[model samples]
Target: MKKIKTVDAIGHILCHDITKIIPGEFKGVAFKKGHIVKKEDIEVLLSLGKDHLYVWEKNEDMVHENDGAIFLKDLTAGENLDFSDIKEGKIDFISNKYGLLKIDVDTLLELNMIDDIMLSTLHNNFIVNKGTKVAGTRVIPLLIDKNKLTEAKNIVGNKKIVNVVEFKPKKVGIVTTGNEVFYKRIVDKFGPVIKEKVEKFGCEVIGQAICKDDTIMIKNAIEDFINQGAELICCTGGMSVDPDDVTPTAIKESGASIITYGSPILPGAMFLLAYKGDIPIMGIPGCAMYNKTTVFDVILPRVLVDEKLTKKDIAMYGHGGLCMNCDICTYPACNFAKV
Candidate 1:
């Protein structure tokens, strides 16, 4: 249904058989409107399966089918309200499965409801840093009441909203460091293997090099990648403590700062993270060549989005290992590897 008039009211519904239901047990409530309809209270209603609830102003369009409800006061049929009048509030678009949150302040400010501009920027999804203009009570939508919008803007006080930093993808350089593969003792499988994995992200391997276990050669290869505009670099093989193992030492000698030597994760505990300035230089273990997933799998997403990684960020992988490759894997639609 088309929206008609501006309004501000809580809309909700019973997910259960509310036709003959108790008040507290079956109903859900929410005050925020015009954005995503997801809320914890709605999940409880949907669990009942048989019951479906919706809330909307008597004069406005119905709440979204995906949403739970919209509460409205006494009004006659055929009357509607414009959504522009309703002040915008916290919008949570992150899916429950990912535990992630996406905040769009541009959409919030367009509605003329941001009261405390500074504090609202702190909310999850608000995510803007200092010097970023989040909202302005002074600016009002055309043809709308500036005074009313001003009143709604004042409601937002200095409540701090959490800022979530997002990662953006950077170009990567892959240096496959192994003699057996480089000298044709075995097929050049590592190159194609890593290429496929990196393709799943926004990163591109602009340069590739093959080097033996000589630290000097490896370090030179890394510098070559930096010269080629590679912000991220990966050295495959030679990660263990074998006498010929030199990938870890090579990364250290390249004048790049090491972020962490290893991670506490399965199938990828030997992973290494180092950086030259903000550019990350990683050492991928041999296991990544054969395994369906590994530490590179975890870091790829962060690298794609240019997000900073912390030890705690790496720790989140333990809960993520529950993934079992499905018969029909829906890559983007599923939470299998959006890490």
Candidate 2:
């Protein structure tokens, strides 16, 4: 049996001799045996009433002439199959003789990490019953084994997945630093701005305090939140390089360890990350309040899932442009944040 190269590939049945098949004027051309089907040629074949081909079903014997291998059913036919029913590990057919196949949901979702050359390396797709090959795997399409991909899928299932831009329950603490804001010489508008964004994440502001540029005061307020069981902490103002822009220093002055001080993202570039044991402390810049591109948006999702962020992770946001405050913020739907 030869290795099959593609995931989700389908084949069709050849009804006649290859040489005898006539190519219509509308049809691009006729194909011969052993001719690999491709993207461009698929439509031409479809127009010639060729629907099924010898699809790679893992078992060489199962790949009858003209069987489509990738497409399982006609989506336009209003017929849909639930992948959940297909089980989490192995690609199996309950009552059919289709040899066992491996479908990895994680890699498939993660930008088709497998390539054609690797996909061509696997041979079996249907051979086991549901749950029989719980860790069902393959190797024909590429170097990645089905077992590893299956494991990855299981990992995804076990972890708490968080989708950004969607309102989810969160516990937040706002630490407002700077003498001016702390002394109330100017109304604390920063607090309200942080509050609005926090509410969007379904966050409840459990701990809040006004601290002068003094590091000890800011550190104490952060500690209070940790003692009170705050999952996330936001420190607004005092983020610049000036003598008074001391939020970064304050977060470090607290017991929390800083993970990153800068990010590639606009509006939130001056953000800072610090962790104490497990609690996260964030230093949000003044830009966060006015530009809507503050550190809060970039790291909030990672905080929800407890992911550790590095400088490199923060650098990935540069591809997307600054938020234009468009009428509709179709994030997650549009990946506007581009994190």
Candidate 3:
């Protein structure tokens, strides 16, 4: 690119977009790249405080920002994602479906390490709605060394840096295990709570059972739900170490493979996760009934996506597992755990 006086720039093509800001009214590109500069444009440019203009000058080793942004977009965009039209040397990657946003953080970091190349994204494993801006890519300058973008592509090779995993609808079963609720001494609040949480993810509660804290009864309830074709079973209450709290023992006795019995997160440390064949069963503590967000919220989305959780996955929650319990709960948006 070559810089010239605005008056001398007439008839030369602009190498970069010129932004125009009209205080509160507008702020966007007024003159796009490749637009031939005209005599009448000088007065308009001067009003925008432009004394100089950059004219297009091709170089084999350098790439124009618009093309560079497209290259970056092609390298990073993955499944269920769409790219916005390039504007001002940048393009936004939007979600094409409502699902979990997965970011290849290692590769993303490597791509951003390349100078003059940028790829910014939302937190990995975040639940995003369709049309949500998942990521954005751009070149730092109007013209950048082609080698820089090439290096970024090489770093992000083969694997997608950003993608969305759509949630699969499942038949959920609720097992409210506590003597008080089972005998109608107290109303069954856990079932309604679990129902609301699962329904938001597009799942249906196919069956529910109110069982006393008897291990055998709890086991039978879980088996009954499975026989009824429940893909996911939630056992609420009776998760603590108290002798009467046999929900965890019941989950094991039901022949489910236990993944993790305790989480590092507060208000949900007693949580238990297991799977019976392809079915996932969770033993939820009392905190889930009171806390708007807990370990249950931390792991529910992942489960819905059929992402198996390892002990290490649960252990990592220690970093951001404590809930702030703000006056207005903004969960999922807040860092309750590392997604």
Q: 1-339, model 1: which lDDT tens digit per residue? A: 222212211243222223324567854333222333345444543454423334333432323322211111011001111111223322221211211223344443543343222212223222222234332122221112334334433442332122234435467788988888778687766778788777644457797898877899999999999998988888888988788998888888988887777776566778888778888888988778777766677676555556667667666656654445666644334454323
Cα distance off (Å), candidate 1, residue 208? 1.0
lDDT of 2 at 263: 69
Structural similarity to truth (TM-score) of each candidate: 0.53, 0.55, 0.86
Which candidate number maximizes lDDT?
3
Give all candidate RMSDs, comma-separated. 14.3, 12.8, 4.3
Query: How many clashing residue pairs appear in each of the predictions shown?
Result: 28, 46, 0
As a TM-score, model 3 comes out at 0.86
lDDT order of candidates, best first?
3, 2, 1
Which digits, one per residue and each the tens of the lDDT, describe model 2 over residues 192-269?
888887676557999679999998888888888877878788888888899877778778877778878876666677
What is the clash count of model 2?
A: 46
lDDT (10s digit) by residue, model 3, range 1-339: 798899888867697789999999999998988666788999999888989988976578977777888988888889999888887679999999989988998888888888897999998878899999999998888778988977886788888999999999899989988889888999988888899999999999998899998999999999998999899999999999998998988999999999999999987999999999889899888898888888888788889899888889889889888888888987668777765
Give the CA lDDT, 0 to 100, for residue 125 in model 2.
21
| CA lDDT of each prediction against the hidden true structure | 0.53, 0.54, 0.88
Off by over 4 Å in 1: 1-167, 319-339
